[model samples]
Target: MPGRNDEDNKPVAVTTSLFMHPASSPHAKTVFWGMLATRPDRRGEKIALLLGAQAIVHMWEKEGARGFMTGVRQDNASSAALCNRLGISDTDWTYSVCIDPEMLGRKNLTK
Candidate 1:
């Protein structure tokens, strides 16, 4: 992850992680990006766009990747906006389940 620091030398924004993985298609070589996050305060500052462009360049130029893929939760309007700004195509829907560590051994869980 790369970031820009404030004048006080404290990091204000960062691209937390950019993971590259092989796509499922066997006909062509492709890459998929994983997580990308920034500090809550810096959400609207275009840091994610810059980092995403850098990641794309790295993948295409350095790693010889053919294409990119990533997913954003439907409820995350911010991420969806960013994807639109980046010209990423809206592809498919995905579902996820989260488990709480404290509820691991419990028979019944309460919200």
Candidate 2:
């Protein structure tokens, strides 16, 4: 969580993660920065950068994390820019397919 005032301890920006990915190599330490968000009002204020840096420091110092990875949606330009600013390269692309639960039970779900 990252914020400017104690009164707003509820975090303007937040980063959360698991210490390791299930698919990660056992011989090395890894951390997955699973989620990141900054309040709509706080966007472009570097709150996300502050929180992200704090998370990385905590992982390296407290958890001995040697590898870090995260996923950002391709359409999220701000997030992609943040990643670029942080020196993280876009190494791969991931594709996802989703279906509405209501449509799951429908017979003609060709859409």
Candidate 3:
């Protein structure tokens, strides 16, 4: 354990209680990459989504991620739009049911 690789020792990053796993190898691929952001309050909807996109870009750059993967609920129009704006083309028709409480709040909806 004393001579383990840093990848095995690195800690995951979390923002607003949403966690992003540590990036160990650039060649290692990760799925389900997403940013958990709450809906805009004083700020406008567009600005909030812009911030989320910025965060995604930053994470991708910092982590050396090859590509991003996330899912928008069929009912979430804004999220779908945001993903499109971020260059995430929809290629699949699968649905995911998340259990995060913060993700369930209406305030968590994107623009």
Score every model by TM-score: 0.62, 0.67, 0.52
Q: How many backbone clashes does candidate 1 have?
A: 0
What is the lDDT ranking, best to worst? 2, 1, 3
Task: For residues 71-91, write the lDDT of model 2, one tens digit per residue.
Answer: 776677777777677666676
Indicate whether candidate 2 or candidate 3 has the larger TM-score: 2
Candidates 1 and 2: which is better by TM-score?
Answer: 2
lDDT of candidate 1 over 2-65, digit per residue (tens): 6677788877654433333335546245555535666666666777788877777776787676
In order, candidate lDDTs are: 0.61, 0.64, 0.51
Query: Residue 12 of candidate 2: its Cα lDDT?
Result: 60
In angstroms, give how far residue 21 of model 1 lies from its true place: 5.5
Give the runs in model 2 whose Cα sits over 4 Å from its true position: 1-8, 22-24, 93-111
| Candidate 1 pairs with clashing backbones | none
Q: For candidate 3, write residues 1-111 as lDDT tens digits.
A: 011112555422221212233557552554454454442333343544555565566556664556666766778876677678778778764645668777666544433
The model with the greatest lDDT is: 2
